[model samples]
Target chain A: MDFAAIIGNLDLYLQGLWVTVQLVALALVIGLALAVPLALAASARRVWVNFLPHAFIYCFRGTPLLVQIYLIYYGLGQFAAVRESFLWPVLSEAYWCALISFALNTAAYTGEIIRGAMAQTPAGEIEAARACGMSPAMTYRRVILPSAFRRALPAYGNEVIFMLHGSALAGIITIVDLFGAARIVNSRHFVPFESYITAGFFYLCMTFLIVWAFKFIERHWHAHLKPLRG
Target chain B: MHKLIITAFTAVLLAGGAAQAKEWTKIRIGVEGAYPPFSSMTEDGELQGFDIDIAHALCAQINAECTLVPQDWDGIIPALLARKYDAIIASMSITEERKKKVNFTNKYYQTPARFARRKGSGIEVSAADLKGRKVGVQRATIHDGFLTEVFGDEVEVVRYGSQDEAYLDAVSGRLDLLMADSVALMDGFLNTEQGGDWEFVGPPYTDVKYFGEGAGIAVRKRDNDLREQLNAAIDAIRANGVYRQINEKYFDFDIYGN
Candidate 1:
């Protein structure tokens, strides 16, 4: 009923928007870095090479993201050893704890996505690279990884959005992300509908931006597969 | 087949239970079992504390059989409004905002707000000392409202969804300070084993504008007769020395602030 409350408190939402963007961006970048190695091991032929990544992926992806966040944020803090550790400074802060959870969670999901894409890479293409005297690692580096990445992009986009949505949970541990801003607004103003609808609108806007960016990248990468114009 | 039949039988029982009885012989009082000294559940699953004892004493005075329904702090008010219980014996502060939805009996008990921190933390209560310090408070509480209205962005105020969560963070050294009802701080945290290192600091915040007229029993606005009965019972207990017995069981000083 009161759209004015949202407009008046736009600064709070915008500040929270910046916090959300920073969290998601950092998590996605770090997650991708971790995911590459994880996917490589997961796609490996040796049982030992794949075992850890398999377990990590299952452990993260099988459980709820909220529980994972709590385990790191509150559960780890429960131990006196963790509290006294050098990492306590960073671990004690909600921002870093949330960052670590989001990154690891996204890495597990993204690792699986890339592993699936790597498996779907054409055997003929890998065979051609090997026949050209490329080493196994070079074949993977040159042909498999590049094609698999292109294949993984769309699914990776979904992971990015999922990570963004997961950032909402950061507020529980006291990081005021976008949804946290809505909660603060609601608590202060007692206007749930107006507060949440504004937050929803902001999320919708960001979702559109992510979709557009991914679409542009997809078109650019898939250009070679397009039929010749002239 | 047995499971389906049992489910139908339970549904019929629940439907029958939903209809309110005209007689006030049996009453349900909602309470938050998490708050210690006021109302907390023992390991044996029995509710005990000042609030529970007072509820029992009041029920005796009115000749009604009362049941204490354990509810979470956040849902306590909404559940009272939903007719899930006849009254909330929870330590609910009577504020103008809540007065719209539910009628509150005369104050059963009142306590001032206080700041608590780790012993020898050496922080004073002034805004200058607390600048950039992380102060933990329960979300949507009078203390939280006070912090926001007074401190605003001057200090880093961390609001949690529960007092237990805030206490956890406090024990972990994540919070520089905590604010809550003085009695809550004493029994819920300070007197507990986990809070051995914590101590109350600064003067008590007894601002009525924010803290309101203290904790009172909350009933539905339509329950005027119930509300009046509760008011009379509160007075009767205070008059007949029953209130003192309950107070002495938990607190040393008078919680019924002048």
Candidate 2:
């Protein structure tokens, strides 16, 4: 393997890394924003309230991300109604289609993660909040959400990494993320090992950064829960 | 019991008949149904194109029944290697790199690579002229290789999974230019309404170092006999004017380059 081939195209690799970061960051923010409401609705007491969110979760989570992206990017474009619609401007672009698919896909998984953590909220904490005469909204805001998020952090961090990896599929729709960059280099240079090994290293570094960041956040938020250390 | 015994005897006779001899009576040929002029799907879900016609002609000459298998371009070769199909009639150029993995027959047709841009774009198709411009091409193709090799440092080469996607980007003005097989560009894009505003720019590039020998049917390396049969069939079709009939159905000029 010629390591110099990889080193020579460092700029292209970095550009790919940047695209991957942008895609993951934007998709994660959108997904998390959607997941909070989705998880809350999915956990609602009323069957009617939970039905749609449950269906949404099942539909998005059950399907492959590649299919979802293709549906958004290609299938939608096939219809005249979609082309003539007001949202055609946003729906037509590959970047937005990829972003929308990634966001919806991660939302289903993240919603489940948050819902699981919320289910584990201690009974004593809820009783204490009720005893203080806190409103249902205030009780959830001050006590439940904070605690649930802290507990959900570790699982959510894994979702973040998965989303980052899944962002590689954006290349299929013509977005030049890290994987796309590696493909371009590989096709051009005809050196699969050098090109992909470089991309793998970049992905590894990103994964480590995500893990480290999550560890720091866990330390800060779960400080009281930590056992005393020497 | 008498009926069961009769059924068993008949089944044994049928099995013996089926085991008598095995010959190349049927062949499955892979094609990328997305590449237009060469191969594409009609609105009625039928595969129709020059490549499909050529496959039919070749199969007829070889006296074998042909089954066209629709495959994505990226996985077409690997699928052939895995025996998903007996041969690939896809417009895959014969290259040394690909030859290392799969064997190819003699050229069925050859075409040069060219760049297309929106009509009246006033952009020159030179390395210095395209510096920092975004050019779209299908990923993992000879055109992609040529662009990257020639202008990797000078231009931004955006890769797509399919030529159709690159054409879409070019139509939407996301790409300043698109590079692909000249005949494919003509039949798949430039001649269509979506590409009405686009025109071919720059000279046709046929550097053997990159574009390879020509488009050929690919088979597994072990299937040399099949490869030879395909080459003979290709020659038979060309000599008998069947190749010209299919060629005229798609292009005005001969795509079988010198």
DockQ of 1: 0.35
Native-referenced DockQ of model 2: 0.23
TM-score of chain B of 2: 0.89
lDDT by residue for model 1 over B69-177, one digit each (tens)? Answer: 9987655676776778999998888888678668899899899999998999998888789889999998778888888888766788898877888999999999999
Clashes in model 2: which pairs? none
Which 10 successive residues of model 2 chain B have the least lDDT summed? Answer: B16-25
Candidate 1 has an fnat equal to 0.53
Q: Judged by lDDT, which candidate is best?
A: 1
The digit string of per-residue lDDT tens for model 2 on B1-258 reads: 999999999999988756633445689999989889888999999999988999999999999999999987766765776788999988889887788778899999999999988889888987678998888888778887788889889888787877887887676556788889998998899999999999999899998999999999888886677788888889998999999998888788888988
Which candidate number maximizes TM-score?
A: 1
- TM-score, model 1, chain B versus true chain B: 0.88
User: When superposed on Cα atoms, how far off is each prediction in RMSD?
Assistant: 6.5, 8.3
